[model samples]
Target: MDTMRDRFAPVVSRLLDEDPRVAVVLAEIGKDGFAEAMRRHPERVINVGIREQLLVGAAAGLALTGLRPIVHTFASFLVERPFEQVKLDFGHQNTGAVLVSAAASFDWPAGGYTHMAPGDVALLDTLDGWTVHVPGHPDEAETLLRRAVAAGDDKVYVRLSVQANRQGRAVDGERFLTVREGRSGVVVAVGPVLDAVLAATEGLDLTVLYATTVRPFDTAGLRRAVQGADTDVVLVEPYLTGTSTAAVSEALAEVPHRVLGLGVGRRELRRYGTVEEHVAAHGLDARSLRERIGGFVGAGRASVRA
Candidate 1:
């Protein structure tokens, strides 16, 4: 049950030590792990306490000065609260930055709705040229973080969750990787939800696709995967429901297809206990996923056997 956050600290410290142009901005989230990075490069590593707005604004300022800044905080604090700063300071300014977020979606359910950020991706979609990466495991997250730092002047958002798949897989960030092949439908599992999606579609006849990068979606890959198949695309994301519905529709506009989007449902305002409990409450558990996916692929009765 180790998290991407555990792997993130050491990587950030190493980056800070290696690159003088790279800076890390903290808003009171992972101060303990990044403490050494701050100690090594006090000029580059910055902490603004709990002020998320200034946290984002400071990163933007650093970007304006030809320095690449990696900002970290909770999803709610990083995106939902300082949206204007993200929109204007980064988007409007046309400055590039790597925004790293922990406790994405409902990872911190005990923190309540104030901490959960189901709509962060949707909000970022409203902006332009922002690359979003939802790494499934620590290895994937590390790859994406390195890429983001190497990618100069390109806005990147890395969403990290506590849940992880059993193993780590190398992510290319440009296309979807096929995990399993079937004849029924194509189930695209985004980031941390790969394990749950794998469990749900264990015995079903469906092609499973895993994506670490959601924005700049691989339309070509998806189109090729569903070339002669039943055009049934099911996108299972960790963010809000239907976050990629528009992109999926745009990608498959030439073909006739039915799409089903699944993630954190927005209807419920109440708490659903622990992270596992919240996942089940949103009908994202293996059983619920089996029922929904099976129903979507026309395997209603057969899905129950799993």
Candidate 2:
């Protein structure tokens, strides 16, 4: 299976050929993949080298001209580094651009903390009118990319990652897809972490909801999934832990519920290790997840602390 970032280049290239208003601005990340597209439409494919701030600023400028601009770079550089530019140039100015990011969470641990961005989704959550997509597979990434490209002039962030699931799930507009059904509780798995979530959740009598388009939060789907069942929700995200806990709370505000948000911890891992090591250390592997999730749901605890 190809990584989400691998599929992104071809998808954007096709978008460039199909739509004249579409443009991609990069910060020297994934430049080689877009070489053919660059040759075809040099003006539309802008590479701003390592200038992360300029990458966003230029994309916003292009948006002001009525062209739908797409910005690409690592998650840290794309969202965290030029966050002020993303806010001022795009949000404050009422401009729109598709910000695509690679290396989700800790894809390249050797690149150091500067390149890792497990908090990108949480950071974007602070902003308004930003649509976020975390596809579990490359095919889903392409589907979401096309949707974002034609999704009007609203801000969109398609998070591409080196990590991916073994298979792809269906893209159902902007709602979560129900992968399995049960009565005990609901486990919401976001992006590439779906496979592990499924593995950990097997035979647990818990409903599994796969999410690709997470910005809108799929409140309706979430509410529906928990109806007449235990209202305990375990959110397994590829990014920071507890990032979507608030959204879950809001969705089930009227109903009695307990939520356990599991993902990358806030504490920085000082040692540079492999992604597998990071996963184990963070307790995100199937064994750890099963232990944590099973304990949480099996304890019969009526409430989860915020």
Point to the candidate with the largest lDDT. Answer: 2
- Which 10-residue span in candidate 2 carries the lowest summed lDDT? 297-306
Clashes of 2: 0
Cα lDDT over the full model 1:
0.90
Candidates in order have lDDT scores of 0.90, 0.92
Error of 1 at 211 (Å): 0.6
Model 2 lDDT, residue 195, Cα: 89
Q: Candidate 2: where are CA atoms >4 Å away?
A: 301-306
TM-score of 1: 0.96
Which candidate tops TM-score? 2
RMSD of each: 3.0, 2.2
Please give, for residues 145-250, the per-residue lDDT of candidate 1 as tens digits.
Answer: 9999999889999998898888889798778898998877899999988999999999888899999999999898898888767788999998899999899999
* Lowest-sum lDDT 10-residue window in model 1: 297-306
Clashing pairs for model 2 are none
Alpha carbon deviation, residue 95, candidate 1 (Å):
0.3
Give a tens-digit lDDT track for model 2, residues 60-154.
99999999998998999999999999989999999898999998899999999998999999999988889999998888999899899998888
Candidate 2 TM-score, C-alpha based: 0.97
